[model samples]
Target: MLGNLIRYLDSVVARDPAPRSRWEVLLYPGVWALFWHRIAHRLFNARLFFLARAVNHLSRFLTAIDIHPGATIGKNFFIDHGFTVIGETAHIGDNVTIYQCVTLGGSNPTNGVGGKRHPTLEDNVIVGSGAQIIGPVTVGKRARIGASAVVTEDVPEGATMIGVKARSTLVKAETYAKEFMPYGTPCKEPCEPVGSQRVDELEEQVAVLREQVAALVEANEQLARKAEKPGKPACKGV
Candidate 1:
């Protein structure tokens, strides 16, 4: 148990630069939240539903992170900061990292039966702050979800998702693909909103039109100046 705890703390230290030592990592709210969740999950599996809920509530009150007791979490899972919500059916794989304000949310069941409503995150997946992975979608291994992304569909392995209703963007640098990237996205990735190309095209057209209008105005002013001069007269049919 001590060895496992040390490894878990080491994993967090590797991912987060804020902690100076393993003891400081112990003070993190996420570690405490996970500790409570381990006990709560065991109680839930034993059919001690009320007790599991009580522990979940206590953990949430202490850590500001709401993880359902029924959620399954694997080894070295790290939640950076707090305000993260993991639904009852959510399954998190080993070494998965979730940033603050991220939600592993569920969809409303039409038949009123609750079964696998939440998302499953594969191993080494990183979710950025405020990212929402809704429904029973599977985020494949090593996929990176960008900040404020809304993902409702399964994400392909090695993909980088960004923007509202997240879409995969081209991964730059094959060598850096497997490296641990902070915030689940590379700082240089050109992640943009849907239809960003069209928006760019429209902006270019508007700029061209403005330049043409400016030139027309300058020509009109030049003609007016020439007409106003005593030496110049308006041309008429000879």
Candidate 2:
């Protein structure tokens, strides 16, 4: 238990720049929430459902972070701010970091009583503020969810998800892990200019238009040649 506490503190300190000392980290709301959650999870695994729920309720009241006791969480998990929600069927992997207002929830809340409904975040995942990962999708390892992104489908490993209905952009996780962005925004790469794909699409359209124009010019020339030929005269208005 002491070892786990030390590891948790170490992880928080390593990831966050604000918490300077272990004492300060111990007082952090996120740390306290995780501490109680560990106890609640143990009771839940032991089939003491009522006690687990009670413990989780208390933790939520204190920390403002609602994590269902039935959810499975791996080590080195860090929540940057409060008001985060983890559903009962949600599974979080190791080295995961989540910011404020993040929700790992179900798409169909009323249905799937016995089945998995929430998302499963794999190792080294980072969820930005107000990001919602819904349904039974598995966000792959080392993936980063950008702020306010709504993810409904599975995210590939080492991918960065951004925007509503989340578009994925690939980035090497090893390089990303070296520096942490406050809102899970990755450093811009040279190859990825903003709206570059749209520009390429527009260029393709222009090329097609040019080709059509050239074809029309050739056809007009052929008609003019036929009209100028001997015994073939241009038609007069009727």
Candidate 3:
């Protein structure tokens, strides 16, 4: 048990350079949250729902991280800087790192059946701050979810998701797999290509629409002139 704890602390130290020693990692609210959650999860599985909730509430009060007692978490699961919530049915695999203010939110079943309402995060998934991965989505292995992104769909393996409604970036996951990226956002070259091209394209389309509108206005004016003059009174009106 001590060995497992050491390995867990060492993993956190490796991921975050801010910690000088394992003792510093112990002070982290995320670490303490996970600790209480372990006890709560055990009680929940034993059918002591009230005790489980008591432990969960206590942990939340102490750590500011709310992990549902029924949530299944694996080894080395780390929540950085706390303020994260994992739902009751959420399943998190080993080495899954979640940053601050993220949610593994669940959905109400349309058919009223109760099971697997929350998301399943595969191993080695990295979720950035303020990310909301909603419903019964499966975040595939090695996936990186960017900060403030809203994901309602299943993420493919090793995909780097960004933006609202979360689209995968053109940059390959292998590029990120080489090293751990802070916040799961690739802030460098190759990840960000030339922009302004989309703006230019929209401008071109607007110009084309303007020309077409102008031509239609001119045609209407010419027709109005013809109607007003009546062209020499059409056979001189007898």
Candidate 4:
């Protein structure tokens, strides 16, 4: 507890010194939070849940970080900046990287009590800054969530999700695909050219229409000739 307190103090000092230096950010609040979180998590895992919760709340008050003791995090986890709000039910996998302003919580509109209410991120997932992954969904291994994306559903393994509500632009189809798949290969099979085939059929129909038009034009000319010079009438057109 004393060690965590000292580290928390160091983090505060680092954030607001006489002259703020970017180098000082190496030991920022989130960095210290990660260190203290491990301790708090261990305490929770050891059945000292009350003490762990107390320490977690105290740390949040001191550091502006809100990592829950119930959240399982891995080693060397660097919280790039502060104000990260990790939820109690969030299950973070090993070697997962997170950035500042990331929110891993539930989107339960009911606000009702009980049940799993946080996301589960698999190993080696890299979440971009200000990303909000909500609900009890699972983000599969090595998936990359783009900055400021709103993820609500399960992301397949090694997928890269982007845009609102997080659509997968690139899917890591196989475990070996990440290391071996060639560039320019389509994520799914290439779609056949239905448009070109329709255009060809339309062209044939247009040619038939043109021929009909030409025949009608000739027949109309014959009729005009007959009308201008009826059976024994004047040869001079009217």
Candidate 5:
């Protein structure tokens, strides 16, 4: 219990330090997620609705975690940084690691009021940051939801969801891990560079565009300030 409290404090502190080392923050989020979840579950089961809501709101405010009071999360559920959110009816299985900005929500017309308006995630699943798993679908055990994906349908066991609308990029776990994910990268898929030169060229172009945009913005601001200033008295020819 004391350990959980310490972890929770660590997680809360992690968010405030943007410049802190990534490795330091990485460990706390997972630990704190499970800790808060235990408290939230207890409050929910005890029918302490107000207390549960308050705790939920406070956790989200402090950790960028937006878990609903009614969400049923299993043991060892790890919610990583980057803004993690779970809907009211989302059912999470054991040992699931969900990264930031991943929304496990439902789109049913009867949602927000009640009636099973969220997805069920099976055990050992890992959802990357910015992934959206919507509706009453089920993600099978050990499945992986890639970054920025939009999943609306059921995902089979040990499958991987990627791309818009979230198709099964790979169904087999071993192959999927080898192809999509990398080692020690915190649920990130190995980016398949189009080509070394191509990537470098695109990066260079982006840098140039950013510079131009910055210059234009600065110039515009200067012009606005000058326009707001009282008209300079007719400049002396001298």
Candidate 6:
């Protein structure tokens, strides 16, 4: 138990930037919630349903993060901010990081009295703020969910999911695991500076414009050739 506590504190210190000391981690809502969740989950597995529910409710009230006692969460789970919701049947693997307002929720509430209503997040998964992963979808290992993405289906391993419908932008999570991404979104490769990206876009636009101009010039030359033919005459302006 002490080892687990130390590991939890260590994970927080290693992953997050704010905590200066181990004592400061005690003040973190995520830490507190996870701490309580460990006890609550144990009680839940022991068939102490009411006690587990009560503990979970208390944790939610204190942290503003709701994790169902029945949900199976693996070690080194980091919830960056509060207001993150994990449903009853949700299963989360090790080294999962979930940001604020992220929901691992069920799509069909009416058919809730069944198995695996909520989604499963595999190891090393990162879910950004305001992202909704609904239904019984399995988010593959090392997958990164972008902010405000709505995912309904299974995500492939090492894929970066973005946009409203959660479009997959292929990025190996192993490449950027050590690098701290603020909103959990991976930048495009050949990662240019803001000014450089703008310049590149302008350059592309200029190239396209040059091609259009050349095509127009060729069309004008063709018309000139037709007009200069022996039997053909140029049309008079209206």
Q: Summarize candidate 4's per-residue lDDT along 1-238 as a digit string, tens digits.
A: 7675555444433323221433464457776787678889999999999999888988888778899898877533546567888887888886566777999987674868757888999876778889999989899987888889999999988888888978988656354334311122322221234446668999999999999999999999999998987476566676
Instruction: Give the lowest summed-lDDT range of ten residues in model 3.
Output: 186-195
- Any residue pairs clashing in model 5, and if so which? 83-101
**Whole-model lDDT, model 4:** 0.74
Segments in model 6 whose C-alpha atoms lie over 4 Å from true places: 109-113, 175-238
| Model 5 CA lDDT for position 19 | 20
For candidate 4, the clash count comes to 0
TM-score of 3: 0.75
Write one digit per residue (lDDT tens) for candidate 6, span 58-86: 99999999999989999998998679999
Please list all clashing residue pairs in model 6, or write none if there are none: none
Distance (Å) between predicted and true CA of 219, model 3? 78
TM-score of 5: 0.62
* Residue-pair clashes per candidate: 0, 0, 0, 0, 1, 0
The superposed Cα distance between candidate 4 and the true structure at residue 2, in angstroms, equals 18
Candidate 5: Cα lDDT at 14 = 33
The lDDT per prediction is 0.90, 0.86, 0.89, 0.74, 0.73, 0.86
Minimal lDDT window, size 10, model 2: 182-191
Query: TM-scores across all candidates?
Result: 0.75, 0.72, 0.75, 0.58, 0.62, 0.72
| All-Cα superposition RMSD per candidate | 11.7, 13.4, 14.4, 16.4, 17.4, 11.1
Off by over 4 Å in 4: 1-26, 109-113, 171-238
* Model 5: lowest-lDDT 10 consecutive positions: 181-190
Question: Candidate 3: which stretches are off by over 4 Å?
Answer: 179-238
